[model samples]
Target: MTSSQEQFVQKEIQKISLPSANTMRLLEINSNPEHCLQDVIDLVKLDSALTARTLRIVNSAAFCPLVPINSIDRAVSYLGEKMIVGIAVTESCGKILNQPLEGYESPAGDLWKHDLFTAFAAKEVARYAKNGMEADLAFTAGLLHDIGKPVLSKLLENASKTTIDALDHGEAKDYLAAEKLVSGVEHAEVGYQLAKYWQLPAPIAAAIRFHHNPSEAIEEFQPLVYAVHLGDIIAMMSGYSTGSDSLQYTLDSHYENFFTFSSNELTKIISDTETAFRPALESLAGKEEN
Candidate 1:
């Protein structure tokens, strides 16, 4: 990003509103970092919408081959604690995602589909990395990664339409850069601010802020960001909208050099993951209709 782009991104970030840090703390407490599966389950049970959404998903067509996960615990046990964490967070995120964001040229619920696809793709990458970072976290992180775009777009109003149109036409290099070029700020900085406002876990927040350009990420999150970047690229190639935003990839040859997997390994991961989660994501998205 150029200096002007950097300045633009910073200037635009001032316009967005995000959830409070205290709320994020409450979310983290409910999520239970100590691995208390029961605490997470108990919390999920209280949020009626969340509980209904989760159960509906478990019993949906995606899980049809297996008998319905009769109750919350049954669903938890069936999906495992990590995946449950991922599911709960994604459900929480779904509320905002379903809203229409004209800034990105996204209609009513398109953002959720894009988010779900990225989350599923991120989960696949986490499964492959097997680096002890839970798959569910990766999934949630992916789903929320682009969250700043909507917030920024909402704040900028008509001013951002040109940027959104450019992204839709594949004319922009990177979403942030394009946003900066037009609105005077990038989405990553805006997202980071939003994450902080939401009190999201540091890792998740960092991942969202840096997923587009993993090369500059700190040590703890570099791999996860790498996975998300690759996942985003693959998703675009597979047919999700790359938009006019995020057209220019910040990857360097070194990123390829450092990637430990062979092309064949990545191919299999992408193919297998798409097949595994497409139905699940589609079913989850359809619940809004009922």
Candidate 2:
């Protein structure tokens, strides 16, 4: 990104609200192993909406529990700590993420669907990566990877026609370059700033920053970055993607060598991602109904 774009991105970052205090507390509790299931239950009970959504998702068809989980305690015990935290973060950002991303040509809820799918894919990929990458962290990173698009969409509303046409026509080779050309900054960089402002973990922030270009990320974050990168690609391949730039991204050839999933393994990963994703989509849809 150019100096001017960097300045514009920083200014916009100031305008966006950070994640809620409850969300931050959940992140803290999940990050610390000392916190027990009761502690998470206590924190979640403080927010009625979080509790409701948690139980709703746990009992959704996607999970297919033998018995319906009615209480927060049962939900916590059934889904486990990591998934509870994931649900908290997702619900916290639902308001912002649920909007249409005009710049990316995504209709209402399209971006969120893509994000949710990527989150599931990332967690699955992390399990296969076996590179010390935590599934929860990977899920968080993938869920928020495209967060900057909403901000960019607002910025693009008043932008020049050339930039708008470029993105619309898919003229650029990739979305990142198109974003930089039009808005003076890319979505990944803006996402990085937003993550930092929200006080998210360093690795999560880094994964958002370099998800599209994993090679640029530092060595410490490479594994996590790779997980998100491949996850995003898998989401796109599985037909959940932002419009126009959906096919614009290039898959890193190195992933085949580094992650080394065989043909059958890759097929399983895709199938499992879809299976995990379906329930999440259904659960969220049910939430909308209520």
Candidate 3:
């Protein structure tokens, strides 16, 4: 990619819509330990769509709450701040992520499914890895990791067939390289720019930017990035709502050298992720129904 083309891609990214203000406020509350429960309820109530989505997800068969949750306040109180924020993040991006991206052969809702699976997988991997990494952070990184894909999809919609062929043929070293060759910018780079624009934490932004190539991530953020990368690969390997880019990228050998997980450990992580993903998959089905 040339410098001029890179500049053009950056300019296009600036034009992409961001998460809603209500969701942004919810994220802020989630990050602050001092925030009270009432703060979450008040903000959530401001967005009826968010309120309904939250209630539906909380009341889903997966959660299996002992008692029914009819109100946003009660739901927030029951699920606590972290879970609520996570839900808010997913809900806020649902419309954008759920859209079909013909460029990537992702039908409506497929990318969202892949994202949720990856998020849960990342959380499980972090738990098994036990590297003092926060599961919620890992989950967030995984969920938002591929956000740039949709943006690129839009660009590819009108791209020349030659460019699309290049992407499909593995002409470059890897998927990112292929993307860069054809589009002048890779999804990870675009995702990072969007993350910064959204004012997300540095670590999360770094993870999104470097998930496909964790070794390139800054030393301080490498572990988190590696966790997300592993989670993404595991999700793809397990055939969890994979998209056109599913097998296009190569797995980094450094992941094995860095984490040093035995075969049994890897199998256990995949199994645990599948268990966790079931409820999420069910919830998505429920969403489609409504």
TM-score of each: 0.76, 0.85, 0.81
Residue 131 displacement in candidate 3 (angstroms):
2.9
* Model 1 weakest 10-residue run by lDDT: 17-26
lDDT tens readout by residue for model 3, 92-113: 6877778887666667878887
- Candidate 1: count of backbone clashes, pairs at least 3 residues apart or interchain: 13
lDDT of candidate 1 over 118-181, digit per residue (tens): 7778777666564455566666667677777766665455655577666668777655666766
TM-score of 3: 0.81
Winner by lDDT: 2
Q: Would you list the C-alpha lDDT of every candidate in the order shown?
A: 0.64, 0.78, 0.75
Error of 2 at 115 (Å): 0.5
Q: If ranked by TM-score, best first, what sequence of candidates would result? A: 2, 3, 1
Which pairs of residues have clashing backbones in candidate 2?
none
The candidate that achieves the highest TM-score relative to the unseen native structure: 2
